[model samples]
Target: MAENSSSTPPGTPPEDSRPRPQYGELAPEGWSWTPTPDERTLATPDAPVSSAAPVAAPHPRGTAPRWDRPVTLSLLVLGLLSTLFAVSMLAMITDSIQLIYTQLDLGGYEPDPSVPGLVTAGIVSVCLVWLATAAGAILLLARGRRAFYVPLIGAVLFVVVFIAFSSAVLATDPTLLNDPNLMDVYGSL
Candidate 1:
């Protein structure tokens, strides 16, 4: 058997890093021990130990968080403005429909009868802008996610859809494309 390297001088006991037995009682050879954990948790026969990670901690709540306060205020303004913008676009679509039908009587110009589809498309575009602005505002305030691009995207979509519809309408009559009245009303000539 290998000799105990920590063997003390003759007639003295060997030293051990672990705690000694009570009352100087002897421990068996090769004895080992593990200390209790720093945290003590009670377990019952029905409880199973789980090694899964703990759920995420919730964010702190307050009446008005610093970032949320300004965002909410800005969202309210944006919501109102977006609604007005949508209404204006709707008015424009109605005006165009009226103009096309009335122009049909102007010296046999015969404006295309397919204006309802264009009107529907225009309305959808306007609604998309309003809906997007509302949804973005709500989501930003609720989740604190970045949604500043929502307004820009909605505006661009409305513009693109309107331009396409307008060009298609005017294309049916090239003479109307150069009409001063259209230029004055659309201001996009």
Candidate 2:
């Protein structure tokens, strides 16, 4: 071979013309790269290792999550209860009116003493119930429950209808006065 300008160092044969080994690489005879015990353990592939523990089972889908807000549930319950109470009162008034009409034979008769008071009381009760329902609905909506709004509005409208019906009944029959016999019953007051 042509004289290799890349000569070996002194006290070494020219056969060592290859590149010197790095600190981490295998060395010449009588020397070798040996990994530490920890390095050897890591390098030995025993089994696949996971960095984190397994997670618990996930919750089922499509069910409503548990509610944390007490006010929301309270408002919903209040709205429902108030609605039921108003409906019950209205139904009672209706039944009473029907009974009066049927028993007194006054289905199409002129306005009389007993009937006017029932109509007036029904109207007042309906108005009061409507106010209560409206208040409950407002609370429910403010607490993020939107389902109660329609029923609440319906209750208010029903109250208005009752008021109108009462007014018409009173206006059509002048005998539907607050005191037809005022001079007899409460003339002192």
Candidate 3:
């Protein structure tokens, strides 16, 4: 029979340079080539046991995985941008409210026929609510568990508000479309 040259010397592994078993493959006395549990039963009683340490079962990915850098950074950046946009919307609404109050005080300005005062108030209230929700979403992202979804929901709300606000402004002030700056940009394009 061919000699079992593969068998390691029966003692501590050689002090000379050699690869050490990383997982639970080496026992105190000698090397253990015991078949994995799925493949076969334990080695015969006379056969040298490979390892006294129990074989470690493979772990499922993501059970304790670290957050990937790119994904986490992307989500964080999105959340921050969403929050900033919501704040800007709130500021615009507040500024418009102030302008309306000033015009009413002067008794020389009138609300647009196409955009009623009630609709403007409603738009302002909606913007405030969006800002609050976006702030909450940004704060919740620190938990890192299903937090990215909050910002996504805020983004949808932002889109709805943006469309409604734009339509109202365009309906009330079609002349704004003729601004020299806008014409210049379009002409350049």
Give the per-residue lDDT digits (tens) of candidate 3, residues 40-155. 65333555677688776654642322443345446546655765665465446535644544544432334466455535554565566556655664455444433445556666
> What are the models' TM-scores?
0.44, 0.26, 0.34
Residue 71 CA displacement from its true place in model 1, Å: 4.6
Q: On a 0 to 1 TM-score scale, where does candidate 1 land against the true structure?
A: 0.44
Number of clashing residue pairs in every model? 0, 0, 1
How accurate locally is residue 9 in candidate 3, as Cα lDDT from 0 to 100?
73
Instruction: Check candidate 3 and list the clashing pairs.
Output: 32-50
Give candidate 3 misplaced runs (Cα > 4 Å).
1-83, 86-145, 176-189
> Candidate 2 on 1-189: residue-level lDDT in tens?
665655756776556566756774766667766779998988788866778997655545432223423444464455556546555554455454445445544454354555556565665666565566556655655555543444546556665666565555445444324334434543564
Candidates in order have lDDT scores of: 0.59, 0.54, 0.53
TM-score leader: 1
Question: Which of candidates 1 and 2 reaches a greater TM-score?
Answer: 1
Overall local distance difference test of candidate 3: 0.53
For model 1, what is the error of residue 48's alpha carbon versus the real structure, in angstroms, after optimal superposition?
43
Worst ten in a row by lDDT for model 2: 62-71
